[model samples]
Target: MSAAAPYAALSPDVVLAAVDAAGSWSDGRLLALNSYENRVFQVGLEDGGVVVAKFYRPGRWSDAAIAEEHAFAIELAAAELPMVAPLVIDGQTLLRHEGYRYALYPRRGGRAPSLESRDQLEWLGRLLARIHAVGSRERFVARTTLDRATMIQAPMRAALGSDLLPAHLFDAYRHAAGRVDDAVAQRFEAVGPVRQLRLHGDCHPGNVLWTDAGPHFVDLDDARTGPAVQDLWMLAGDEPMMDALLEGYGQFRDFDPGELALIPALRAMRQVHYAGWIAERWHDPAFPAAFPFAAEARWWEQHIADLHEIADDLF
Candidate 1:
């Protein structure tokens, strides 16, 4: 078994046992949830109620960092923002059982928001503005910051160091990555003095759920300190969508138009980081099964070409 199969020992019996130990009565029902980085389950209680149990990936985050994530979710919920906070068991949101850290959340469900709709985009913008308002009120001392070093350079190094990139394509990948790095730095320098605040670091559409009431955000697992634009850009796919989002966002808080310049740079960083992330986790069994595309030399060729295009945009 590979080192990445840390959860191999975590069977359905163990999931039910862990939930039971956490003071929730389980009737031996467990359904695995779709997650790659961590193990999550929809556990059914004896009373017919269901709650989501999330087992944090071993060694991915420190206890302090997880606590910060939980705190941020709670803070957002307290402010009446549509965020799902963890269920507190015995006055603590985080719980440990048999050396595994876990948390339980009341199950909430909604469909993906239609970003194509201007009204929906504006509504999402308002919610994000409110979330950012609370995020600005404090700092995450233990969490990471989304910056060039962490998001770009670190991932680039991981990719360059890894054996996953075919030896023949390594030079091409490195050259394109270098250009991307240089361009990203120049863009950031151009957008000088952007404000940094705690944010839903991975605020893409998958993290949001929409219903008749409104949109609710889930999974603060990637929450960290960064420019507010990090939360907004992922939701806006085009110019009109961005304009609509900003229009609603401006209603709650003042937005700096300068941050708009960071979009291309941010997009480039995400592309590089995503590839690196998959490479870093390839040792894990789930990655290979889920991202079979990464195994192809042709994929790397296209990826390098895409990076070059991002560099062009940045230039």
Candidate 2:
């Protein structure tokens, strides 16, 4: 294992031991879940049941932040939402064992939701509105907010400071990033003030699962405070899609039409932040292997061009 993958220490033994310490009898059956930021697993119990254990990335979140995530899930679950909440053992949802902090959840299974279906999209919209209703009830004191400083400026600084960008293309990349930043700021100003509430933070389709009963939200790891549109825009591919979503969303919560304008700005911010995220994690073996495109000079050139294109669109 590469020294960069800190999860190298999270061997099967450690995983099972953590579950065992949490009062579950591991049947020695373990299946690794698909996750890069955190190490998650499905552990079989002696009673022929399975539970999912998520071992948080070390140093990524403080205990308070993690607790807040747990609290949010629990709150959503209490509202009868289809969100998966961590199981409380010994009066605590978060468990620590062998120098790792983890949480266990009851196994909930569903396939990815079909965003192409109108009914599905509307259903999702209603669900999201309901989630936002619950989310708005409280604010996250420990979590970060989605804003230009955290999303654009910080990412730009990190990218320019990192050696990931090719030396030859550094100036081009910097210039394009600066243009994109200016455009994003102008776009936000034009959109004017919008309501900021507790949001799903990362509400892409992959985070949602669907079954006959409807959709279930998983993974509150990226939960934070942001505009309601932040959760809605990722699901929409075009104007018609947004219409369908908003049509359903109106049934539950009133959405500000002004938020639509922020989509382009949000997209640009995500683009920059994504690159910075990959660069920041380049030291990790998983990142390099998974994002091989980031290592290529041509990719950086294309990325710079894409940034310029987004800037033009925003303006």
Best by TM-score: 1
How many clashes show up in model 2? 0
Quick one: RMSD of model 1? 1.2
Model 2 error, position 311 (Å): 0.8
lDDT tens digits, residue span 1-315, model 1: 136687877889888988898889999888998999999999999999999999998888899999999999999999999999999999998898877889999999899999999999989888889999999999999999998787888888888888888889999999999999999999999889898999999999999999888889999999989999999999988999999999999889989999998999989999999999888888888899999999899999999999999999889
What digit string (tens of lDDT, one per residue) describes model 2 on residues 1-315?
A: 343676777899999999999899999999998887888999999999999999988887899999999999999999998899999999999999777889999999999988889999998889889999999999999988888888988888888888998888889988999999999999999989898888888888899999888899999999989899999999999888888898899999999998988999999999999998888778877788889999999999899999999999999
Q: Once superposed on the true structure, which residue ranges of model 2 sit more than 4 Å away at CA?
A: 1-3
Compared with the true structure, all predictions reach lDDT values of 0.91, 0.91
Clashing pairs in 1: none
Over all chains combined, what TM-score does candidate 1 have?
Answer: 0.97
Mind sharing the TM-score for model 2? 0.96
Candidate 1 at 21: error in angstroms?
A: 0.8
